[model samples]
Structures are given as C-alpha cells and as structure tokens.
Target: MSISEQEVRHVAHLARLQLTEAQLRQMTGQLDTILSYVDKLSELDTEGVAPTTHALAASNAFREDRVAPSLPRQEALANAPQHNDESFIVPRVI
Candidate 1:
C-alpha cells in the first residue's frame, strides 16, 4: 500500500497540483500510512450488518405543512421603490 515517488507525481499531475520535492516526499509517506491503516480495516468481517446513515438510530422530526393567508397586494407593494399599474417596475436589461 506504499505510494512511490512516481505515483505521487502522477497523482499531482492529475489533480493539477504543483508540489515541491519536500512536500511530495512528505505526502507520499503520509498517504502510504493512511492507505495501509485502511487496508487493515478491510479485514473485518461484516457480512450480515445492515448499512446505516448514522451511528445512532434516527427518525424524521418534521412539522406538518400548512397553508396560511397572504398579505393584500397593496400592503405587499407598499415599500417598493418603483412600480407600474399592477407590478413592480425594474430597469431594462439588454
């Protein structure tokens, strides 16, 4: 699971990253360690476990949707900076 210098260079090229020699060497070791640790986790047996969205049990906690009265047209348009007969007026765009 160790990443080589050449592999690190290839990855950098794909990601459009420009890493210094020191950074590339450092990242290669770090990424190799992380992948090796993940490889260890892959050895666990969990054939019968159900997939879950969260570690703890969860349920929807939604409020009921309801319709309510709306403001009158005059009240809704009272603070408009500019307006035409029945609609707000706005500057023209090309």
Candidate 2:
C-alpha cells in the first residue's frame, strides 16, 4: 500500500503538527516505504510458526515466596516523629 501526501497532511493535522511543504512530501514518501515493507512481509508463509511476544525465549527471574517474621511493633515505632504505644500519629486531612 502506498501513502498519499493528503493522508500524511491529515495525520499531521490530527497530531497537531505544522509541517512545511517539503516535510509533508518527505513524510508521505517515508510512510509509503514503510507500508510497502509491511505488504511484502504479509506475503510470507508461516502456517506452523507459533506466535510469541518476544523474539527470544524468556523466563521469570523472581525468587520463591516464603513466610518470614515481621519486625516488632515497638521496634517499628521507635524512629517515628510522633507515635502512641502502637501506631504513628499524623496531621488530620480534610
């Protein structure tokens, strides 16, 4: 598929871009080239090929989750600027 200068102008207008006459012509040619390459790729045969999100094989690198002991409430509140016996105090919001 080939791209026209009018189509390029419309796209530029939609994107809020102000293009010079030269720039519009350049973009039209560039878009035409890209569409042509896409059209060429559509002619390839891939009946048995599996679809993939990435070009190469990928695996998760996350570590296994485990139950762990949490910090004591007294220790956690030790560094607070304002706190009662249990929780930290903060300025009231509307």
Candidate 3:
C-alpha cells in the first residue's frame, strides 16, 4: 500500500504536474494513505451483500415517443449571432 517517491514523480509527470521535491514527498505519503484505506476496504466481509448498480433504487419511467412540431428554419435562426441560408455560422475549428 506504500507509494515510493519515484512512483509519485512518475504519476505527476503523467498528469502534467510540476511537483517539487517536497510536494512529491507529500503526494507519495498521501497516495500511500489512500491505498491503505482501499486495502482496508478489501478486507471487509461482504458474504451476503447483493451487488447494486446504483446507490438508490432507480427505475426508468419512460414516456411515449410522439412526433412533435419543430420551429421553422427562419424562426430557429432568428436569435442566432450569425447564420447562413441553411445553418448557424461558427468559428472554424481547422
């Protein structure tokens, strides 16, 4: 359950973090503590517990699908900041 300083540094690098030596040491300790807590959780007995998909009892309350009228093209584009004859204009991505 212990995390080494090297491992902490590796993780920080992967996460694009600029951790100092002192920060790395602190992160290593914190990661070790978190792993220890997880190890403790693994030791818990759950012999009779049923697996659950959600914390709350959830059911899908579905409604009927029906055809609905949509706004006309002109009305839909009325409030747009910028639009063309067919669609809204937006900044080019590439």
Q: How well does each candidate superpose onto the true structure, as a TM-score? A: 0.59, 0.63, 0.82
Q: Kindly report which residue stretches of model 2 are placed more than 4 angstroms away from their true locations once superposed.
A: 61-94
Q: Over all chains combined, what TM-score does candidate 3 have?
A: 0.82
Candidate 1 per-residue lDDT, tens place, 27-72, comes to 8998899999999998999899998889999789997998989888
Error of 3 at 17 (Å): 1.9
Between candidates 1 and 3, the lDDT winner: 3
lDDT of each: 0.90, 0.95, 0.91
Task: Show the lowest summed lDDT stretch of 10 residues, model 1.
Answer: 82-91
- In model 2, what are the clashing residue pairs, if there are any? none
- For candidate 3, write residues 1-94 as lDDT tens digits: 7879988898899999999888888888889999999999999999999999999999999988989998899999999999996899999998
Cα distance off (Å), candidate 1, residue 62: 6.2
lDDT of 1 at 42: 89
Top model by TM-score, which number? 3
lDDT at residue 78 of model 3 (Cα atoms): 91
TM-score of 2: 0.63
